[model samples]
Target: MIICELKNNQRTDALVSELVDIWEDSVRATHSFLTHADIETIKLYVPHAIKAVPHLFVARENTGSIHGFLGISGQKIEMLFIATQYRGHGLGKKLIQETMSLYPITDVVVNEQNQQAIGFYEHMGFEVYDRSAIDEHGGTFPILFMRKP
Candidate 1:
């Protein structure tokens, strides 16, 4: 697989749509705590979020099929999603490692109910430093704020 940062002009609508599909698939696979309605509601903002993130990196196969992506803003990882079939194959880790080498990434927020994600972040050397009863969107899902320190 190859990982590369996307240039501004490369973030076309078609790419955003593809990323959104990956995001939704990943969310459905890992975020079982979310109801269908919750997913639908959150999906509305994903495209915009993908477009607005300061740095976007994609992991793709040699054949040029994207399998995962990471989004960073400031010193935080705003998003990371791997296609369901690509999970556990080190693509996510590669993305994080590559981005950390280029950016001073220190923080990431994960859903408390998503134990798999929490464990993954912990394995990646992040520790929970704070917690919130609601998500950023004011949803009921708890949030765990982690930092690499």
Candidate 2:
């Protein structure tokens, strides 16, 4: 697998579409608390988010098939998603480590219901420093704000 940063010119509609598919697949696998309708609603905006995020990185096989991606803005991790089939293969961990090597990422907000993600972040040396009863979209899914210390 190879991890590389995507330039702004590389954020084409086709690439954003592919990333959105990866996002939906990963979310469905991990975000069980979300109803189908919730996923559908959130999916509408994913492409825009992927296109607009300040930084984007992708992990791909030697064959060039992207299996995971991360987005960063300022010091926060705006997003990270790995294709369901790629989970547990250290792709996400590698993406984070690669990003940290290039940027001073200190914050990542996770859905509180995603215990696996919380544990993963904690294992990566982040700790929850804040919480929100509603997500950024004003949804009922709780959010946990974490920081690396």
Candidate 3:
């Protein structure tokens, strides 16, 4: 079972490796990205930035080890990662349900290449507002701007 927690001061208390492991697993499972290095970069800087924006939900195993997470920057989803082993049990959808109630509008950016995520977001009630030519370094990387209000 997945337990959802509101992001707060104790988020970084989760081990960095477990967080990275979640990303590593998810990216591989979804065929979205190439490696865990993106998460490695986050581990280096996200903790310090957490104080400025402290809302992050870290998923822990029943044994209390971090396995996946979803972070919110206001109503916008900043990060969502689920360890491969723990996915398909509804953690991702649960996180969205638990988080979206906190805001009036919720928006998420899904990389164009990630077909699985695109379908998942659509299933979750987010609608694609517009497609862009990669503004904000978006051109080379297509981003589906999804909004649910």
Sorting all predicted structures by lDDT, with the top scorer first, yields 1, 2, 3
Q: Is candidate 1 or candidate 3 better by TM-score?
A: 1
Instruction: Please give each candidate's TM-score.
Output: 0.98, 0.98, 0.76
lDDT tens digits by residue: candidate 2, 1-149: 99999988999888888999999999999999999999999999999899889999999989989999999999999999999999998999999999999999999999999999999999999999999999998999999999999
Query: What TM value does model 1 have?
Result: 0.98
What lDDT score goes with residue 39 in model 1?
95
CA lDDT of each prediction against the hidden true structure: 0.96, 0.95, 0.68
Higher-TM-score candidate among 2 and 3?
A: 2
Model 3 TM-score, 2 decimals: 0.76
**lDDT per residue, candidate 1, 14-76, as tens digits?**
999999999999999999999999999999999999989989999988898999999999999
Residue 74 lDDT (model 2): 100
Alpha-carbon deviation at 70 in model 2, angstroms: 0.3
Off by over 4 Å in 1: none
> Model 2, stretches more than 4 Å misplaced?
none
RMSD in Å for model 3 = 3.3
List of clashing residue pairs for candidate 2: none
